[model samples]
Target: MSPRKPDADVPPGLLLVDKAPGMTSHDVVARARRVLSVRKVGHAGTLDPMATGLLILGVGAATRLLGLVGGHDKTYEATIRLGQTTVTDDREGETLTTTSAAGIDDDAVRAALAAQTGPLQQVPSSVSAVKVAGRRSYDRVRAGETVELAPRSVTVHRLEVRGITRPTPDLVDVDVTVDCTAGTYIRAIARDAGAALGVGGHLTALRRTASGPFDVTRAAPVEEAAAALAAGGGPGVLPLTEAAATVFPVRAVSTEEATALAYGQRITATGIAGPHAAVDPAGRLVALVEDAGATARVAVGFPPAS
Candidate 1:
């Protein structure tokens, strides 16, 4: 690992966490702070407490990269209960209504899911984290107010019905896999699908499988991550060099060019796209650069000497 700057405290990089159920995303960050023993820690995306799976976190300097990471598409596996509606659109919320899904056939379920695939305008659930009047919609709902949220554009690239199970005449459980753009709400899809079929619906389970380039497969268990950090060992951050190369385009720079870029000087674009990583010969990240036609400008620089 490269040596930290004298003024640096904790190492800077990304940490991939496989979040456990019943833990909020902020709770994960709190645990990370305790383990890593540094105050600077931030997650790229928010995962609901009822949801579990991959969560990408940026520690120290890596925090700057989180905004870029959050925009990527995501994949999720979920269970939709096609018999009931909930205030929160998920199992965690109080049941608002119930209807028999006994007559709904596989064809009906397929047709409903098919309608939700592709581009559409979706109204997020009232009990969602979406900001309304600078307050969370969920918070407003909890305070006994009915929140009607505006519909937003979201894309569901793919929706595959994994399985269908009938535990009772009135209840149907549909397991599904979803690949969607950021800002999509799977719970809303469930709610809408059930509503369309004349049976209210809500999400029963949700597990994120992938977020951008990071997947649950590569994520460290939260407990294990904390233990590693508490032991005064590495916090399992994705190395800065690897993170930059994997998430963006790459440009190799000689030591001299790396120094120039670090010192805020522009270099010739190597025909690579703008916002590419400029790596030193030693494979360390030098900075993030953007192509300015004739010259490359520094977006963010990491001076090797520092």
Candidate 2:
């Protein structure tokens, strides 16, 4: 085997990409690596090939922050088609059933979706990226194995009906905006809501509008950003310190405290409720710290870039 390439020269930062439809989350990461010439790129979360929206890419040392970043709440705009159920719970999959939704009125749709709002147990789609028995659910499904996923606790903070339109006599398309906690599946929402109304449903479209403090509006188009990078212009990356501050509470530490934390020593309590970004006197991120009783301990530390 060839020797592994070193990523020591790659700058650590985050890139917010407005992913176009038909590209998987991994596809965007691959493109970033090629364009930015960085080998340590990874995405915080994955988006289906059929879905489009904001995708966060972490480069170099910033990859360490992705786990916490992926835990944040997310918002999405989706179009659910009532009357058709698909094997994957989305339009990309084979149609499993079709029932006329002519009798399903607007109020019925609204009420059914409203009922799905709040804390609930959600079964992820059988063809989801969720892992089962050490392999992806989708991989198992593709191998002709029946996949049954267990229900997970997820919260749907809001489900707003944007519009309801009938493209055909038997099919109704409902546009909705969902604000949900991490891991909430919008596809399952459509499926359950349609089942409640005596019809079947599947997602026709999905676009993530927001993830925590990052939004689609602030994301740069993937190709555009890549082109800029190739041309020696800005890569549109948010530097590490700024990205950390945007996602977590900020705690400015004294020079002495920064040194101690850098050496893996505990400092005084931050008084912050949760994990916070501790920045050195020079405004560089030193570590993510949380109070352990009366003292703050480093959850993750970033040694100064040499």
lDDT of 1 at 266: 95
Clashes, model 1: 0
lDDT by residue (tens digit), candidate 2, 1-306: 999765435557778889998999989999888776778888988899999998998877888899989989999999999999999999999999999999999999999999999999999999999999999999999999999999999999999999999999999999999999999999999999989998999999999989999888878877666555445345455778888999999999999999999999999997767999999889899999999999999999999972
Best by lDDT: 2
How many collisions per candidate?
Answer: 0, 0
Runs with alpha carbons beyond 4 Å of true place in candidate 2: 1-5, 226-236
lDDT of 1 by residue, 1-306 (tens): 997534335556778888999999999999887666767788988999999999988777778788988999999999999999998899999998999999999999999999999998999999888999999999999999989999999999999999999989899999999999999999999999999999999999999999988888877876676455444344444766777887988888899998898789999976776589889899988889998888999998776542
Error of 2 at 124 (Å): 0.8
Q: How well does candidate 2 match the true structure, expressed as C-alpha RMSD?
A: 2.0
Against the hidden true structure, what lDDT does model 1 obtain?
0.87
Task: Find the candidate with the highest TM-score and give its number.
Answer: 2
Worst 10 residues of 2 by lDDT: 226-235
For model 1, the superposed segments whose C-alpha errors exceed 4 Å read 1-8, 226-236, 304-306
